[model samples]
Target: MQTRVLKYFLTVAELNNITQAAERLHITQPTLSRQIMELEKELGVKLFDREKRQMHLNKAGVLFQQRAMTMITVLDQTKNELLAVNDQLSGTINIGMVESAVSDFMMRAVQKFQEKYPDVRFNIFDGDGDTLRERLDQGLCDLVALIQPIEAAKYNYFPLPVQEKWGLIMRKDDPLAKRKAIMAHDLYQLPLVVGRRNIVRDDITDTLKIDLNKLDWRVIINLPENAKQLVLSGKYYHFGIYGVYQKYHDERLAFVPFSPTKTTGHLLAWRKNVQLTPAVEKFIQFVADQTTHKKI
Candidate 1:
């Protein structure tokens, strides 16, 4: 398929409106529709379900969209690489990372990488492990910083320097906050704001072996900033990475580690056997080299 046709398909897939997509593509609506119809005919599958004024991707279309995205990313990267001369890196570095203390390594690596390849830009996407992994599988990001236990065989990974400590962030004035370390038993009946990532929560639950029903789960927070604000209310506690609170420091809050000192390693991972752009490859090596001494 032509790259332009793939671009058209992606535009329609994104907007889900023929008129909007045509306008954005600077092509006539009929021409855009004809292209999509031709694409469907070529693929021998209905790509969309249309009714009245709306159009949505069918199952086949959804599958095609994933492949189309990866294809487009590869094509774009290949073009950029071929156009570059010598060691000058000029493409974007798309890195997705979960919110945690381990992000310090990602940031530091990016800083060092940029210093070497000044023209290389970074697109940082933050989410929970699942979201980030979904983006990686869809070829939206070149690399991802994930807190383990990931499927080790799924990707090639470099260990990040820090083993992030799991803990509770609570108001300093809270009686439990005075304790040096928090116990799973200490959390019973407390108003808690936990991350929405099932893996993180599952690890904690499995480690503590506590009945989740016993805790007053106030909210399931996805955004770290929102979780930070929730803890500021003094009525809620957040189960989060230890060092994140250092950046969002509050005199009223304290980050107390778990009694048994639960910690999980972080990894910077990329899809196995996928072709990486030179910029991405360089950045990955830079990260690995920078953290060489600190790797866990």
Candidate 2:
């Protein structure tokens, strides 16, 4: 299938409206519709569920969307790599990372890298460890920053300087906010928000000796940034690390470290056997060198 057609298909899937997609693509509606029709014929599957003015992606279309995005990412990365092969570094480095304190350190590394190689650009993608690592494995991401308990068997990584101290973020006016540290029992029967990752949830439960299923799980989120509204709602406490509150500057929220201390740190990971582009190689080396001075 032609990459251009894939773009058209994805555009339609995104807007879920043919007219809007055609307008956005600066193409006539008939042309765009015909292209999509031919694409579905070639694939031998209906990509969308048509209902009135809305066109929702069917199961096949949902899978194809991921594949299409991967193809585009690969094509872009390949073009950048080929253009920058001879060296003075003028390609975009795709970096995937989780949303946490690690970002604070990662940006510092990026700023310094940009200073030295001004022509180089970066595309930063954020997700949890599983999603970031999947992109890293698919060659969409040059490197991914993640928390501890990474897949040591499949990838090589370097520990970042930022440490993740377990904690809870709550409304500043809450009674528990008065405590410097929160004990496990403090959260008993309380409305709380926590991450949905199994590994992380297990670790938290095991460390705190609290049953997640027993407590009131008010909300479940994929990343720390999403918990802001829930915590600010004045009815919930976000179960996460110190990084949660650090990233948010709302004076109404407070983050308290867990008593007895459970901590983890971040790692910069890349695929084991793949050959990295010159730009990504230099960027990883820069992160390794920059992260060394800070005490781990």
Candidate 3:
């Protein structure tokens, strides 16, 4: 399918109004409608559900929307990579980050990198490690900051300075909140919210020797923010690093470090076998220089 047609589909899918989508796309309404119908015919599936004046994505449309967006992003990045081959160190670096204390380190690197290469720019995407890895695999990200238990061994990485301390997000009024650290038995009686990454979960399980399934595993979350609203209910606890611990800013929530002091470091990684843009290569070297003493 043509990229222009895909853009038309995405525009309509987002606005859910043919006239508004056509206006935003700066195209005639009839032309937009014809393009949408032809796209559906080409794929042999109805992409949208029409209800009188409004249009919404059907199941097929929803799935296609994701693929369409990915295709567009890859196209844009490929163009940028080609343009970045020139002598000028100008290109956008798509950086994926997890919500860890190490993300702070990444921002610092961004600040320094920008100061040195004013022509370059960065697009930052935040998610859990797994989500970030998926984007990196799809060539959506140029570099990603990942915390410990990184299983993507195919990618080359350098350790970031500092490590993340494991902790619990607790309601301030809870009696356990008064403790300096959370013990194993403390978790046995409490309902917990945890990350979806199995490797990290295994580390926590082996370190604490607690069976998570035996406890209340009410929900699975990719980021700490999703658990914040649940934690507000005072019925569940969130396991996260000090980044989210200090980030919540809500007076009701208290951060309690895990007893025995579990910690994990972070690494800045890039996919293997992909041609690196000049800006991305320089930024990687800059971060490596800041994080390590090794000569580049």
Put down candidate 3 lDDT per residue, 1-296, tens digits, no spaces: 99999999999999999999999999999999999999999999999999987999999999999999999999998888887888888889999999877777788889878888888889999999899999999999999998887986789888887688887887899887899998777787677888889898788767877766566666788988878888888899887777787777799989889877898888888998888999999998888777676322
TM-score of 1: 0.76
Write out the backbone clash pairs for model 2.
none
Candidate 1 lDDT at 16 equals 88
List, residue by residue over 133-233, the lDDT tens digit for candidate 1. 88898878889999887876889997887788888988888887889898888989888888777767888778877678787777887767877777888
Q: What digit string (tens of lDDT, one per residue) describes model 2 on residues 34-79?
A: 9999999999999999999899999999999999998988998899
By summed lDDT, the worst window of 10 consecutive residues in model 3 runs over 287-296
On lDDT, who's better, 1 or 2? 2
Instruction: Give the CA lDDT, 0 to 100, for residue 53 in model 1.
Output: 56
lDDT of each: 0.83, 0.87, 0.87
List runs of model 1 lying over 4 Å from the truth.
49-63, 81-85, 134-140, 170-179, 196-236, 244-254, 271-277, 293-296
lDDT of 1 at 145: 94
